[model samples]
Target: MRLPCIEIIGCIAAIVTVLKLVTLDTFVFGDVQETFILFLNVHFLAALMVVFALAISAYKYLRLGIELMPIEKYVFRILISLAAFTGIWALSTEIIRYFNYQELTSAKSVSDIENAKQLA
Candidate 1:
């Protein structure tokens, strides 16, 4: 039997999403130092959500005999994905930098700095 197109698309989407999650969480970019518990949880959860959403919807279309856009439409999908991914990268970088700056600017709170300084 012919494998359904929905399955095909779902597989592709799942692979891409998981690969991205790995790259980000593994610091494959060489600069990701996010060790914060919250950020790690958020990234994993978000990736899971996106994977389930895309996979389920693709499977639905296959079972219902609905037509997914043909391969010709993939170019548009790719372009949109690129734009959204770029935006995400840009925004995450900005937020991380802002938080790091905040941490640095906070006055010393221990003797490690000067013993009787801002901690008092």
Candidate 2:
């Protein structure tokens, strides 16, 4: 049996929220990069679930000719859009933070090398 679009969308939104919370936890606790892998995994899973839901919804509507109720139609649209937007936002934030962290560490290493050269 095919699932309703709203249910699928709700599941996606809930997953995304949970993933965001996990990432927030890492950010707040000063966790190591290894621990941050959990956050990345959560993000990946959330994105995957959203994509899967969209595909299922499309197949059911297009192939099976199933229709959603008025409220479910609008809410599904909003939830899917929000899920895509927030997923992109979260991923980009993580990428920017990673690059910034890399830049800072590299600069510090370069400065340390120069200092050692002067001391030798």
Candidate 3:
């Protein structure tokens, strides 16, 4: 049987996600840069890849075109659901942190402007 495109996509996404997570801290955070620490804390990139992979896998299973053994199907479904949940959780946490950073910066800017106006 021909392998489904979705499965291929999912596998590739999974591999890419692993590579990003492994190399992100080492290459990006290692002795070269320190200023982007906050942005890197987001973890959005890895989580997004995971979610994409899970979504594709889920779609493939839902379509029911690929003939998978019963056990294999069950295993994939469970794994996909669990992975999707984890990805969503990570994504939400990172998004919250990103938004918080934005809010803090905006507030500081507004405060600085107010202080400048008072001085003027």
Residue range with the least summed lDDT across 10 consecutive positions in model 3 = 25-34
Q: Residue by residue across 1-120, what tens digits does model 1's lDDT show?
A: 446675576557655765575466533322323433334445434654664555455445455443444653353344345435544654475466446545644543333567655576
Better of 1 and 3 by TM-score: 3
Ranking by lDDT: 3, 2, 1
Q: How close to the true structure is residue 84 of candidate 3, measured as C-alpha lDDT?
A: 62
Model 2 agreement with the true structure over 1-120: per-residue lDDT tens digits: 546676666556655664664465325324333334534654445555655565455444444433655544454455456556655765765675566556666888999999999999
Arranged by TM-score with the best first, the candidates are: 2, 3, 1
Q: TM-scores, in order shown?
A: 0.33, 0.52, 0.45
lDDT of 3 by residue, 59-117 (tens): 76667735765544664665476566656566555555655656666888999999999
Please list the residue runs of candidate 2 whose C-alpha ends up more than 4 Å from where it truly belongs after superposition. Answer: 1-67
lDDT of 1: 0.50
2 in model 3: Cα distance from truth in Å?
5.6
Best by TM-score: 2
Question: Looking at candidate 2, what is the lDDT of residue 47?
Answer: 52
